[model samples]
Target: MKSNSHFSNSPFGKQKANKDKANSLKNLLPPLPLFILQPLLNHIVSSVAKKHPELFNRLGDSANKVFLIDPSDLPLFLILQPNPLNPTLKAYNQNEIIEHDTYICGTFATLMQMIDAQSDSDALFFNREIRVSGDSEAMVALRNALDDMEGSLAKDVAKSFGVLSKPVLLAMQKFSKNSGKENG
Candidate 1:
């Protein structure tokens, strides 16, 4: 019998295999320390708030409301409660769905792209690439806030890494470009 295993061992196949392995590794990671992550999250949000106060300003009463940002492709979720006084981030295991006023669900790439302002929020929502539930007001406010922001959150986020930021960002962009290519 001619071996059909050759196709399974091709470059595209290997890429898929690597992606599967990465997903598995991510699944195996232990629950991270919320306290350690909170400060970092706060800093990012604070930076954004400083740059565009209007976003948070629009939040009004909903500023204190907890919003769940769930990435459908990952085994984790993030809870964000925007506070003019103190913004914080709380991460949870996939199964630990907590009560929240608003929930924004999307693939990891879609969420990242949305946060980065790399794509149109309305288009993504209309295309069904993103799903929202619960508080529509809070969702609109948050989306508008992010959308109205002038700079790239992805760039700001990378800069948070200090010296390693450039290299990391480059690698990520290259990886994204490579992975996005169609395999013939």
Candidate 2:
């Protein structure tokens, strides 16, 4: 009788390994809870407004209306409402604001990029990455505001997620590599 190989006999073992690898990758992704993040984002915007009021005015004039859509939520969108009359710079989540002429976007990263580039709205739209419904002028204005705010926006976003700490980010990367090794 010929000796059988242990590895060849168990197909389930390979499947389990694959599943574990997928789980590990899932765990490696940064934990970003939008509910907690929403307020932090608001604070960052307020901080930018305070630190550079001119930038805020530029954005306000250029992007009179803006919408942030959650990719996880698909059709649902979050509209940023910065009270023009209020000094405190309050941000509201009003559904009605979505009806206005605005730049509709899916993710914060993409939105940051839009604000940074100030002229990629058409590109994003062509790629189906962003969907704008009305007012080209408003879109242009929104882009300009993003340009003005680009300097501090990225840092503020990173800080909001606690990734501003280099050590912590490095540690997480190391942990992810180790976990990948174990899974492999």
Candidate 3:
């Protein structure tokens, strides 16, 4: 019998599937109020803070400044700042234009790659794949702090889930490798 794998694997089919997934995500992530979102962001940041105190400490002055992250594919930006009274971080939003002091703009995948250390910050900035504006000094400090990390933040985050961390990480790795092979 002849194989019909070619049909399901067609480029048009793949494009449509990707578009559908994107639409679904967009629908799911509709603008959320900061009050409702604060706890979740705090929890995630607290977990990271516990794992790496030095990282936050190294942020030092930079932590005092508000850093805005704009995911190119999303409608809103994320504002991150280290809590003044504690080591925890807080995320919130404000009006569109000048609400933020600095901006880190990039696609979600690009952000993930940065966190995973799969790509170099200098190269990404040079290629214009990621853009930073306003408060270049603070941005540099933030970048340096991230570059100094001992391991992938993505992996660290996965491992935060207790016993399922390993399995979840392995599955993510396998999926990433397989997807790369498929696209390449």
Q: Estimate candidate 3's alpha-carbon lDDT, on a 0 to 1 scale.
A: 0.61
Identify the candidate with maximal lDDT: 1
Which residue pairs of candidate 2 clash?
62-141, 62-142, 115-146
Sorted by TM-score (best first), the order is: 1, 3, 2
- For candidate 1, write residues 122-157 as lDDT tens digits: 898899888776667778888876777777776776
State the RMSD for candidate 2.
Answer: 17.2
From the highest lDDT down, the ranking of the candidates is 1, 3, 2
TM-score of each: 0.70, 0.50, 0.66
Q: Estimate candidate 1's alpha-carbon lDDT, on a 0 to 1 scale.
A: 0.67
- What is each predicted model's overall lDDT from 0 to 1? 0.67, 0.45, 0.61
Better of 2 and 3 by lDDT: 3
Off by over 4 Å in 1: 1-39, 171-184
Residue 41 lDDT (model 2): 51
Write one digit per residue (lDDT tens) for candidate 2, span 89-121: 222222222233343543444554565563376
Model 3 agreement with the true structure over 1-184: per-residue lDDT tens digits: 1112332343323233234335544445655576775775676677777777777666777777666675555444566665435644444332233244456766666766776789888898998888776566677877777777788876886678689789867875765555344333
